[model samples]
Target: MSASELVFPPGATRRDWMADGILAVSLSLVVIAVPFVWLGGTQEPDPRVVGVSLAMLLPLTLRRHAPLLMLALVSVAGALHLVLLDVPSPSLIAVPIVAYSVARWVPGHASRSVLVIGTFASLLGPMRWFENTTSGNPSVDVLSWGACLGAVLTPYAIGRRAREVAESRGAEVRIAEERYRLLLAEREQQGRLAEASARAVIARELHDIVAHSLSVMIVQAEGGRAAAARNPDVAAEALDTIAETGREALHEMRRIVGVLRAGPEAGERPTYAPTPTLEDIPELVARTSDRARLVVHGEPGNVPPALALTIYRVVQEALTNFLKHAGASAHATVSLSYGPQHITIDVQDDGEGVEDPTDGGGNGLRGMYERVASMGGSLRAGPRTSSPRFRVLAPLPAPPPSPPPTHRRS
Candidate 1:
């Protein structure tokens, strides 16, 4: 290792170097007093004491990293200091400090063993020191052992308590981080679900709009082609109707496209015309070239926009299904009625009762269901039980009734 590397490790801060300096200074005092220092009367010093104390204090810098080993070495050094020294040496104090670190780091069973050894050593060393200085006195030995045991226990207990508190704080931090991660994942899943739902709604709207408009144009085109052989004027009118239908579809396609383009892009907001409603039912019937009849009952009152669109889509899908599946000879009846608390729409057709390609689990039918459900409505679609006609009846919720008028007293 380089000289600088030996002095301080990589990323070692000023505070770390300061702490090492402090520990070094404190342990130097213990090292100086242990072996080389002379007692009050003795002129000569013991070389063995100096060697053992230096071994103990030099390892104090590495005590935190290798606490158990450091404590063991310091304990041996303290024992040797008691055995070889003639005069009392205070440098053996490094043992109790290392015992605290061992208790703070080592496993419970091993640390308990170390603590017991430390207490025994603390008791025996002082008593042995007394036996050498004065005569072996029972009361003096007891006092010395008790005082030394109490000193060793104090630091160990404090270190162990601090370790438990630190461990508890670390566990709480981990639990909180786990909970936050779970919450973040849940929010991400919710965003995906919401995006999927929005896409589904847009798909349904586009499917209903394009499918119904195209079905009518197809029927009219077939009629125009056949009728041209008999009456050119009638065929010409059908072509005109097709052109009008195409234009309407184009305009609506632009509106829906604009709606789809809504995002961070500048000036892309949709400019929707008034949406189709029950009032537009007559125009829808007329455009079918007398293929369907419109029958209205009760007062046609204004309804909510969503409910009106639901009624319109139901009629459109039913008529499209009739044209595509029931052959050109089929005729449909479109009916609407305003009730006290609801508005009902019924579309029925008398045609060849062939199965529809887009009938079972089809997007058109699914779209129809979505529309009705959005307006708090219910729809039943199938061939009539007794008749040959296919029918779809949708009943939608409406505004509540106004309070009835009270009779006036003249």
Candidate 2:
């Protein structure tokens, strides 16, 4: 379907065959001319000489196109010329070249077999010629035959090995390219998933900030309107509270926007306002308490702002849930314990717990779980053993060392 899928039949190009034909024809002409020009006319040129040369040169044109047939034709012509009349010629050069072409270009097992057989046959031609010669020099004959065989087989062996090496290297390159492509694809997928997670987190923070603030504003406005006709001072205080709450909400929104704008280039330095911590717990309780009382225990210690913020939010959300679901007579107890390695916060209400409080498919509890997990801590929220309870426990990361103290004595 694609260009990569298209397959080409293996063989030499037309250019290759044409080049070999030209070389073979030129060499034959030179070899045939040597006897006439250089040998001083001692032996007359045979009429079959032209015919034998043509026969040898013609078959080479198709050496790559039809290698087996071409090798057979050249070998038969050379052998015939040798047996009938001894002729000194270079026509035998075509035999080995054709053999090498067949081995290098032909794709199938059958072609390779043909190439091997033809190579052997080509080698035998010189051996036969040397053996039948009247010359008694055995060493010369052996060396000449060996040289001929070596010339014929060497190119074939070298070409075959080159093709094998090229094929192996090509395969390795393809595998490496494929692996790189897959790794890039995986990284892109992970990046998309991370972006989606970040957007979801931002959405939850926006919802909590807007929903909680708007609810409080509505309640304060109604209270002020009702009290205005009866007590001007009380209505003025309610108005002031409303304004303060609105400003706090705006500040938080601005902080959220700033955080969202901070990109990767913002570096590892902390940005936005310091997150709300346990010190802000009294304010959180007072906001939703109405007629309820707030009590806290434990010596204050430095805690990671991220974990502290999580604690504050958990308590806030728990109180909000209690306000909405619990009766008006319901009251809550907020407790905090700072340990050597862990900080624990509990928001317990003396009212009817949910039919199934554990069923927290909403993003509120899920967000809390994610925040706690990010700090390498855990959270559990359900009914207390004795009374209704919503508990959150988080392990605080070790504090960074304080700067050296400076003191001046009188």
CA-lDDT, candidates in order: 0.74, 0.67
Q: Kindly report the root-mean-square deviation of model 2 from the true structure over all alpha carbons.
A: 6.1
The segments of candidate 1 whose C-alpha lies over 4 angstroms from its true place after superposition are 1-26, 29-49, 86-93, 106-113, 132-143, 265-273, 299-302, 355-361, 386-388, 401-410
Question: After best superposition, candidate 1 residue 163: deviation in angstroms?
Answer: 2.5
Off by over 4 Å in 2: 1-88, 106-111, 127-132, 135-145, 218-243, 258-271, 291-294, 353-361, 385-410
Q: What is the lDDT of residue 189 in candidate 2?
A: 92
- Looking at model 2, which ten-residue stretch has the lowest summed lDDT? 1-10
The most accurate candidate by TM-score is 1
Candidate number achieving the greatest lDDT relative to the actual structure: 1
Model 2 TM-score on a 0 to 1 scale: 0.70
